[model samples]
Target: MFGLFKRRPKTPGVARLEPLGVDVTVPVNQSVLQAALEAGVDFPHSCKVGTCMACRSRLVEGKVKAIRDFSYVLSAEELKAGYILACQAKLAPGDRIVLEVDIDSQRPHFPQLTCDGRITAQTALTHDIVELRVAVDQPLQYAAGQYATLRPAHIERAREYSFAAAPTPGGDNELRFFIRKTPGGQFTGWLFEQSRVGETLELTGPGGDFWLRAAEAPLVFVAGGSGLAPVLSVLEDAARAGVARDAVFLFGARTQQDLYQVDAIEAIAGRWAAQFRFVPVLSHEPADSDWTGARGLVTDYLAAPHVPDLAASHAYLCGPPPMIDAALAVLAAAGVADGHVHYDKFLDASNLAG
Candidate 1:
């Protein structure tokens, strides 16, 4: 075989995002995410400031470094596993590098649009959570469980929140979100402490791949805390579509006080009695306590006796990363198809500020 010309480094560098199968140029001054987006690489992203973990990717082969750490969203083990926030990592100028983009989930192609939205109402859902209803200037085209990014005035980076109600996928202009106040986070702190209704936020995107997919099997939804947002949205969507598929929702909380929107959910379950069931689980309440219902981790309900023929079900998971991680194990043990199980792992802002 004839020898090819000796390989040499070029003046500029390139990167590859796989699974999606895309290649793009990377500049020393710009992050890999910025370069990839300019080159049209489709991936999940929110809080472009590197806190959301939406643009997380693993370094497969080449050299890239992060300007800021995302320890809150990614555990130390994951960091060692080659995960890097694409929005924060960049290649050295004139350096050769290869990258393995870690995109574990998929979403339908929807052009992300940035628009103006006004808060129509802000009602407390729990001691620390609020239901923020917004009316966008123009209708957003999104699936029931998708999320939108809000760029609050005082915050430099945008925050991602999943829709809590299902408006028409391509027709509705109103957006609902369940927001929990993070103790020391940027956006949440500002929203809880200083923000008000009748205010405007720059909304962008309808990101995420956590919506309910078409499946013949029954739907089992496991949600914790504010993670109920997308679950509720999807359930409403299913009801609106007149889907007769059986659905069981297991909502977990530390105590009964943490649970919200019970009447609303119960109403839906009652109206769709033949097809829907709602079960609220408490993790901290004792057997002697006043609450009488399912208790313990949300996964407890999936254990053998409670559910029969779990293998024939499609499971949807949403909540904090810890809950999502644990539920994944149970779902796996239950024999749900990898493709039939969809999830959205929530991450809170932690130690991102200077």
Candidate 2:
């Protein structure tokens, strides 16, 4: 009776976000990122799984209980500077937390909304990729290059997919995505197993910071597999805005059969305000085949003389971890500054299986 009557420990606290001058309540058992999101705060984030480091914030003042070791993703200097992954840090019970987070002014800030959507169509894009068109219950507003989390009616965990096209000025109730079936991906496996048209899904998003920045630097875009989704969105948006900047798109595929949307890209190039080059690099194309384009890994072309000044370009990359890693190495070797490089790594079930 005494134990039951005793005062319970207070776990809920307030987190003060600097630069933004906002305070959000960190609920008991919720991480700082979770709290911020619940409060409708557009704190930067991607792969809320302690990866990506997009939600990295400096602990200005407070005690935090880390759910996992931050040393794996955060550098020693960053750790020394009190930097922490907000998704992995929970406010200590009854402690006031003060955090410093850099908010980009150019990044679009839209209220994240949740809505139900029905799969209206699914078209095969390649042997392992499909294009899904969903009609959401309410208009979903998102910027080009942003991704959304989707969960089917019965799926336990949601998967992230980038918007395959640019958004309309008002909003678009119809959303599109290009999904590549990962060998053991839960959502993807279920999606490709059968015709899922008319099936309902819950979506939460407009997440990630992969959108195009306002810059005059020449553009270098790299994509592979379904990673082409965001790249296409960004390009479409740029074309619509009449952005007059030289750009080159490097798309990687295993063979001719893997290529899709070549015609659409050509159409975009026609509308582009400046010179635009689309290079599709085939890695496993047959030697005897009629394919005459570049051969070998896509990164090989990063050094080709035909490529523009990579050292003075803004490079946007989206793809599997290996491809992004390879592209990063190539760009670094070509003298592309780290700040000029933007990327979004597509992670599948195998990546988080550990």
Candidate 3:
């Protein structure tokens, strides 16, 4: 429907998906993601519109044609990185292609321990995102800024997601996640439509080295969409530890409708009002709205006249690749040492790629 994909092959072809170890025939009429679903081999995917790149896979072998703008999600830099959006690619008829679901799985130090959990609650945080609370059977001992891999009960392939909150006061039986429901995505579509409380989901890990470093310097946090998950985790944990150093959190969204959990964030930030700042930026808001907040890309806010000094602080960013890249450029220009900044860029299959 997006008209972003080229004509698919009329004949079926073989595709071997790694990690999940699924080898299925992809019908020429259907996308690779669809084929996986048909075979009951749930694969990582978001917008089947070919916009989100949630179904991104690495071509280990074979040939194909992928039509993408390279300006949206898929880009020349990503192509060079050996990743292709499966939803946008047309497989050569009768040919076989081998692919790996994720690149990080190849890393030795990465621990991907599968854990079990049951949905305790699912709340609509906004028109697009939902806040899911899962009670795990076992504690997921991890750093505040780390993430995990999530696989819905019906999904065969697991997607990565970050922790939205720090561990509970007494134990780690419960975990939280803020998820965006991408249109045309099977997993999120079911999540927003048919999923129910008590639904069990398989979880894995305490992945990523992006956790908070020692709170020695001031901090700047930049987030986009559910990227707020891990940043909020770090902040909440810091607040509990009474480690309120001067900090600023700048969140960006396309419009007011895209923003969520504002009141909850404001409430938590109230504890450190003297040292913590929360600024939400809307890039495309209607002029008629009564909203009178910062308007533009978050990077613009970092460069604004009244912004505080960032050169002496540590910066943490979690969001789409484009926003992360832009924020890095802005921070560097503001004299924030490259080593002083930490970030978790969401180019993984976990993203709701619309």
In terms of TM-score, the best-performing candidate is 2
| Sliding window of 10 residues with minimal summed lDDT for model 1 | 345-354
The runs of at least 3 residues in candidate 3 whose Cα sits more than 4 Å from the true structure, single-residue gaps closed, are 1-112, 169-171, 304-306, 348-354
- Kindly report the root-mean-square deviation of model 1 from the true structure over all alpha carbons: 8.0
Which lDDT tens digits does candidate 3 get at residues 211-271?
6667478778899988889988888887777775888889998888888878767866887
lDDT of 2 by residue, 1-354 (tens): 455577876768889999899999897699999999989999998768786677899999987889888998788999999999999999766779899997778989987998998999999999999999999988888999999989987888878899999899888999999998888777888988998999999998889889899999999999998999999999999999999999999999999999999998999999999999999999999999999999999888885564778888899999888898899889989899876888898886448420
TM-score quality measure for candidate 1:
0.76
lDDT of each candidate versus the true structure: 0.77, 0.89, 0.74
Ranking by TM-score: 2, 1, 3
- lDDT of model 3, residue 187: 67
* Candidate 2 ranges with C-alpha deviation above 4 Å: 1-10, 65-77, 352-354
Q: Between prediction 1 and prediction 2, which has the larger TM-score?
A: 2
Provide C-alpha RMSD values for all models, in order: 8.0, 2.6, 9.5
TM-score of each: 0.76, 0.92, 0.66
